[model samples]
Target: MSAAVTPAARVERWFFPLLPNSRIAVLRAAIYLFVVVDVLVMVNDVVPKASAPAEFYTPVALARLIHLPAPQENVVLALRAALVIGALVAATNRLPRLLGWPIAVGHLIWVLYGMSYGKVDHDHLALVVALFVLPTVGRSHPHDHRADERAGWALRCIQLAVVATYTLSVWAKIRYGGWDWPSGATLMWAVERRGTFLGEHLVHVPELLVLAQWVTVAAELAAPLVLVLRGRALGLAVGFYLSFHLITYAAISIHFLPLVVCWLAFAPLEKIGQRLETRPVSLRRGHLARRAAAGQAVAVVGHEAVQPVPDPAERRDA
Candidate 1:
């Protein structure tokens, strides 16, 4: 007889779903790769910002609490070197705990160091949270698709962060911009300031920008629905958000690549890894089978050289 599941147990199950460790493995590699790219290309200003005047340095709250010093050129360079090298090594899935924890901590400080200069980008929320949680998954096999609660927990943390990015954006909009934010000329102002040619043209269509602002708010407000959506619905929801990011970038030249990368938490990326790992093995098997069919002599260890076995009909005739 089976015991009844308590409400707490059910909540636990939902929170720590038994997803495959392979998914974590794939997600880890992708995230670490993105970190290397991010430091090099997207947020490549840390070292340069170190060259800025000392008077301009204003540490964020966490930096202030920890008494972290303002970025120095030497320190920033060393941090960048360590972060890039560590991210590359960690992406290979070797010594996960040893490499991953430092990368996570180093990246947090790196972001703080960069944002200390005045401008702070919120797109990093999901990515930073992802780096911290990914280390908790430890080592996961690229070929092992077996369900693991630990991997699920780590992925759930990332997914939650992703959701929070959107939901919190709405809160900030309302809190800072007020209830009239959606109806206001916020999008129009952005278009007028930094928008691409497409965005500039789109703004001319009367009330279009206002409509877009409202739609953006409504979509973000419905962001929580992504957590509860399943199967095709979930895929569509993720797809929709991805499409939204692409469109946003196309129109405004602004992108959320960091947060976009973290969206892979909801994907079955384990399947991609599994398929890639098995492809070579499958090809080798096909090669051996083809050689055997041609009656080619094959050497067997601890046995004599042998020809392919005869078909059942051929054996009967003999």
Candidate 2:
């Protein structure tokens, strides 16, 4: 007779399967790389805030808890330097936990410091989640052949965070904007405020703007499908989600690097990491072809494993 299933086991089965370390390793690299790029590229505008008058530095709740100093030039520069260097070291998978934990703290401080000047964004949710979780995952070698539950846990959590970003975005719209948001001239309002070159001309088209508003809401509502999808379905859904972001960016000139990078959690990153860490593509393909020709079993596993090919001679004899 079997015993009753425990809550822990259920959670493990559903959320934390054994996976190759390569996946999390890739995720780790991607998240940290994005952290560096995000600071230098996407969030660089916030650096100027450090030089603003002390009167303008209104810290957020987290900043208050930590009793952060006023955003001065030296402080911001120090934080930026630490973040860039920490992220680069962390991406190398060297002293991961030691480097990772501090990077997370630094990045959080970085985000809070950026927000201290007034403007804030919800886009950092995924990046923040990745930063905190990566340190918990510990060491995950790229060429590992065995499954790792710890690696799976971290990747899945990142994936869930990615899904929640889109899910909650629409929820916010509905919560704050109510039902009229979709039909309303939301696009027109946005276009009038900070519209890019493309959006400026489109603002005159009332019908198109209205259509875009509804489409935006509908697309966001579909974001939760990433949680339940797998295989080709998940791939297609992610592709569409990315396309939607691109379209919106073209129209509004907004970028969500954190959210975009988080989507890597859904990718077959182990296989990708393997390819990236191995020889050139042509040489790697030749190696695999030779292996196949020698009647040896060859298979690749990612989000799911491909069926191993059987030797032709064995099949013929059977």
Superposed model 2: Cα runs more than 4 Å off: 1-8, 276-318
Best by lDDT: 1
Off by over 4 Å in 1: 292-295, 298-318
Q: Write the per-residue lDDT of candidate 2 for residues 45-156, one digit (tens) a residue.
A: 6568877888999998889999988877887788889989999988888788999998998888888888887887878888898899888879876666468877878888
TM-score of 1: 0.91
Clashing pairs in 2: none
User: Model 1, 124-233: lDDT tens per residue?
Assistant: 99999999988888888788889999999999999999999999999999999997899888887888888998898988884988888898999998988999999999
TM-score of each: 0.91, 0.82
Best of the candidates, TM-score: 1
Q: lDDT (CA) for every model shown? A: 0.89, 0.83
- State the local distance difference test value for candidate 2: 0.83
